[model samples]
Target: MGGQVPSKLTEKFDPHRLVMRGTQAYQPRCIALEGSVGVTTRCSIHPQRPSICREVLPSWESGEPYPQCDKARIAHGLSPLAPEDWIRFKDANASAA
Candidate 1:
């Protein structure tokens, strides 16, 4: 929706729906054909992001990381968090909080 739509999908896809109604009722679209996900995986509209986005917390605070974050890291060849990592993360952020 932000960039030029692929010619192949032009006939079958509705770019408007992908861009305007991609996220509905708290469900987010994967492709972000909406352009909400930025190049670095941060929300493009972070300052004005939805309530659900604001409610998500990293593992350190919640005691368990988001499964999707862990899955993505593993898919990219990174290790999942060890107990020590969580301990350190909690220690580091505890003071900030």
Candidate 2:
């Protein structure tokens, strides 16, 4: 679930719904989210998270910008992610492996 690239066949963990849970009324968050929403966060079920979760971010891996990703980060008082962030993450993950 935590991999940068999930396989086509197993990319989605949707049973037709999202596990939305909001700590604040202003925004809806995922129940599987861990750590802080804006400052630092990771999915508790990264491997099994829904496809929407994986693709909703500014998908530099796919060469697409999803406004929703930056919007959510801004709402949470976090800076938007750049492609370099993704690159760093990918590199770190590769090193970890």
Candidate 3:
């Protein structure tokens, strides 16, 4: 099978999981400019930072500020969307044994 090659840019863009912390413990959510926890220097996932990072302006669209990336969905009054939801949806149509 022939397909286009994936560039380094493609490998560094993940839309799914957000990278919270690397191997370090007790890292602050917001970091200093020059310290080890700085935004430009000590990011947990420096390479794969998502595009949505810039679009997260606090209270721009509403009075509530933009929450952390992990809780983005829940902040919008939606559930975490667990896989169990799909299982339950499937079981609704399942025949009795």
Q: Which residue ranges in model 3 land beyond 4 Å of their true spot?
A: 1-72, 93-97
User: How well is each residue in 1-97 modelled by candidate 1, as lDDT tens digits?
Assistant: 1234333322322645333234343554533234333233554444544444455555444666676566655655677655677778679899889
Model 2: lDDT equals 0.63
Candidate with the larger lDDT of 2 and 3: 2
Pairwise TM-score winner, candidates 2 and 3: 2
Q: Lowest lDDT 10-mer window, candidate 3?
A: 1-10
For model 2 the local lDDT of residue 33 reads 71
Q: How would the candidate models be sorted by lDDT, starting from the highest?
A: 2, 1, 3
The lDDT values for all models are 0.49, 0.63, 0.38
Model 2 error, position 76 (Å):
1.0
lDDT of 3: 0.38
Q: List the residue pairs that clash in candidate 1.
A: none
- Minimal lDDT window, size 10, model 2: 4-13
Estimated TM-score for each candidate: 0.36, 0.55, 0.21
Question: How big is the positional error of residue 4 in model 3, measured in Å on the Cα after superposition?
Answer: 24
- Displacement of the residue 10 alpha carbon in candidate 1, Å: 18
lDDT of 3 at 30: 31
Model 1 C-alpha RMSD vs. true structure (Å) is 9.8
Error at 37, model 2, angstroms: 2.2
